[model samples]
Target chain A: MTTMADRTDATTTVPTEKLTLARALTLGMRTALRHDPSVLLMGEDIGRLGGVFRVTDGLQAEFGPDRVVDTPLAESGIVGTAIGLAMRGYRPVCEIQFDGFVFPAFDQITTMLAKLHARSLGRITVPVVIRIPYGGGIGAVEHHSESPEVLFAHTAGLRVVSPATPADAYTMIQEAIASPDPVIFLEPKGRYWDKAEVALTPYGTPGAGLDKARVVRPGADLTVVAYGPTVHTALRAAEVAAEEGTSLEVIDLRTISPLDHDTVVESVRGTGRCVVVHEAAVSHGVGAEVAARVTEECFFELEAPVLRVGGYHTPYPPSRLEHHYLPSVDRLLDAVDRAMAV
Target chain B: MTQPDVLDTVQLLTPEGTRVADHRYDPRVAHLDPAALRELYADMVLTRRFDTEATALQRQGELGLFTPSLGQEGAQVGSAHALAPQDYVFPAYREHGVLHVRGLDLTDVLKQFRGVDHGGWDPAEHRVHLFTLVVGAHPLHAVGYAMGVQRDGDVATGDPNRDTAVIAYFGDGATSQGDVSEALTFAAVNQAPVVFFVQNNQWAISVPTSGQTRVPLVQRGVGFGIPSVQVDGNDPLACYAVTAEALDRARNGGGPTFIEAVTYRMGAHTTSDDPLRYRDAAEVAAWRAKDPIDRLRRYLADAGELPQQFLDDLDARAEELAVHVRDTVHAMTPPPAESMFDHVYATPHSLVDAERAWFRDYESALEDGSVR
Candidate 1:
């Protein structure tokens, strides 16, 4: 119901609206579809049902059935066809219903979608975007609430990115769609309802981009790195740390596959301490990669061993134990305290 | 387990060098004159020669691997020849006959086998996608591509050159794959202008077609609500007629069709596979007697359609291609080590760029004798 940006140019003053992350993503997809005729949306219930999370609420009616297709309930078919559609010059934005549901299409994603560009010797470019509502929170059970970003990040051909804020959700979706390579767009389902004043401008912002890591809050002591759902937890921990006279620099790694190594390395080089946080399991997750990179790049500048705060190396537990399973403000603070102790 | 008759499968040209008339599909291949039939015969012969040369190359350590389509040339060429220039093809790795029909350079295909490249030709230029090694995955791609063609308003355009269709080539083994089933469902629901060409070549490595399916593979398509048919895969005319009818129906917006070409694999699944361990020699001999090329050759020779000059010219062409494949493969070298870092992503990634820079430095250091 909120009126998105009416302005066409950068200089025109655009109004900011308080929007949920889900609404922001809907508006982002709408903006992209309006701008490019080639961009279309495909998924199970994305058309008339507006997606389970309602991320694609009204775009289907506006764009017509051809542009916003409600595909048959098959994950591998959704991704495999998207690859084919990409080959035929249509940039398809596919919505995988949930994070765990993406496994059905994992073979198509990891083998065909990821490797086509490289194996074809740069002859083919699949500008396809797979939007997965990821991360565990809420009261949902099993496949509905899961964090599967790291599974895709390990693949070379895919550009894996997760947006933290409503504004980021708005812009990053368009950026992911515009990318020539296939992208795994992980939307933090936990933060889908979180509201923020989003600048309803066109895709790319001057200073803020999709691939780079943004240093959200600056400090002189230790640095906290997180993405997607955990970024909020990291900020809350930073706020508490600030009141406690402990200056904690918080960096939101918008893109995970590329890692924004320069920004993380630069921040760690300056702060001399770093703690990586995520909602995925602790071992061999994003935290492990960040820790290894940080150690290799800033080993001499370290004040302590790089710490990681995340869920245990077990399947995401039931709702009753989810809070303990997921990285939280208290868990992040605990990691901070340990790093400070070192 | 009885031998299927004309009531079960479409047989246009019998293995004994005779043409069988069918009211429904006879019109489909009516345009193929004697010259066209000879050309189709030449394509099959050339495909077999290329397969033989590639197999020899693999044995000689020139190729890393080779997937031979020794007996399925009739199924492959017939289906491929039915395609329009605008029509796209998604082929399994063994579709050398389809590749030949699409006018792809055999030497370029050898690049993949020789380990010089993963895929050698530009798919866009030829309207043929790169060979898919993964079983049953490409059928979904074909359906998706057909969906794209539909969106482009290229279907049912009434203009032969404007309207387009897509064909996906997979085997009986791929029918059991979940992706293939999904592709059939999507194609039928969307009425995407695509054809599912299943070359039921009797085996998927060590397993027979019976292991992959309980009923006829054609019935698999019918179960998904797509129109399905069975054809004599050893008869090139039947393969062509059935595929042409399906493609026409697709281009005209009649929806998808599934054609199961019943055939046999005269060779092992690949160069590394030995058929002597799995199947009976008597079965091989029976299928060998029904050789697709021999069927066409006998038909042409008996019908006074085969000229001595044409046969000599065709033989020379096949030999020349074999020599070219051998010479090109023998001269191939591994691509530059730095090239490994290329094309991982179309856009630049910091990690790949950093690794490439490090590799360059390491190689230079080695050249300068600074480090090993």
Candidate 2:
């Protein structure tokens, strides 16, 4: 049995290591549990199975059943109970096994969890972090592949964020746990095994905040913005665009709700064009919100209209046809090509 | 499977106002002094007055709507008084008596119905949660809070003052909701210290209790492995005794207990509802004969505990409360328009701040005639 001390020694000694997004999330939960006694993990199959994606792998063994609870297969109960636990002054990190399964808990999440803090007039703080693995790419059945980030982001009280890389996943999960407001942490399932070097140490200062966009790749021709699983596709598209002398900047919108409008507007003004990409449905999706905002804010600076590349207005197809349904590198480049046409 | 007989309900005070012995629950009520009984009676009387006045206010177009607990006063008051101050309560919308017993001002309770605030009182201060309008949703919260109480080492402490339990109050209709079933499951599995108080008031808006479940609600808890009892809800003494025992058992780490307080809704589901369209007058007359307040009044009178002066003073007190509710409800004003954006999140978000600023500008623009 690896004791807490031994685990700490191992993490501290390994200053930086290449870890997958799933492993980084596990490390983040571990850090949260070690830092605060109030932190708890609850979900179906999250305890014994370490989650279907193994995002919470080995956490139950280390944290004990009390802290890492395996709940009954009821999404509403998991989230509703988490609200009550939050009211009792515990920071509960709830895992909604998959994105599509979140609908069962939607009433609890949107009505009670999202509205409780405000209804109490700040007397109560629902410090809950709801982690959902979202987006399509994995050849899985229905209900497993979906990008429902916009549903939470549109809600007033919730703070919605998605992390593409392992390093940001490691840091942002802890930040979401530490936040006083309820946060919807959309984990990119397709990127779960994609590895990158992550600093074991904490990022930024204590309470440095997590609602900001990051410029992953710099260019001057046009700004290509994406988040979560689609971020890598945008980066690859940017690379492909670079070879053709078309300088395409890539911006990873870490926070979806607040939009980090300043960073996005500045980038768009610099490039004079913009293209937004997401895996959710095109109409009223996060991409649409971004397109609307960019059009509103950087209307005068735009050489071309802000374009959007996203899933068609249809249900997430079966695994066999998901490739055709979800946004791809070629689709993003085609949008970029249209932007350059102006 | 055969359904449990409805007559198996536990009763201490008969509908005729006669006190009777309850073998299982009498011990819990043995400690209630004359003063406590009088206090319980006063709680019911004042709560009824408050509820009636709120309903009248709604009819007069002063408030948006009102849900009256006119007939279930005994159940709410008795169960609420049975709880200790440290205990937490998750109330469904029609818990006026419970809120009053928990020390919430009548005017504060009316704020939500008056369209002034969602919930005017702070739950942390009173240990009473805000009214959950969604039926059966709060039981899960109650169970979760009980689990937290358990985690805090607040149960099985042997000290009655330190140990805590949670009570979730929902109507008979809520039993059909999936959340309530899940709550029972969670409460049983965790062995959490909680009391599931189902006031089987025989009506869920327009639908009758028969439509909700074929078996008695008490039996529903038994299936979930929770010890359950059915009490004559009109008998405050019985309600008090059963709830006290259940809460005690829970505080002592005895796990969850379900108490189905058998009662009736003598009024419409809400001020907006019309009972005449669905039910007959004979049914209302039958329940009126078994009025909880009248039975209690007869008991106090027969026991020689009530005097003419005391009865008159109680009437005057009820009138005073009615006036207070009416005046305060009328005096209540809507909060500032910009205040709507406050408390949406614990910390400030640029989006909310921007929206608040835009609203302020829009309001100012309208005031100064900048645009139509």
Native contacts retained, all candidates in order: 0.90, 0.68
Error of 2 at A14 (Å): 8.6
Clashing pairs in 2: none
Tens digits of per-residue lDDT for model 1, B115-210: 888988999888989986888999999999999999999999899999999999999999999999999999999999999999999999999988
- TM-score for each candidate, following the candidate numbering: 0.97, 0.97
Least well predicted 10-residue stretch by lDDT in candidate 2 chain B: B1-10
- Classify candidate 1 by CAPRI docking class: high
DockQ of all candidate complexes = 0.87, 0.74
Residue B185 displacement (Å), model 1: 0.7
Q: Indicate the worst ten consecutive residues by lDDT in candidate 1 chain A.
A: A1-10
Clashing pairs in 1: none
The superposed Cα distance between candidate 2 and the true structure at residue B83, in angstroms, equals 0.2
Clashes of each: 0, 0
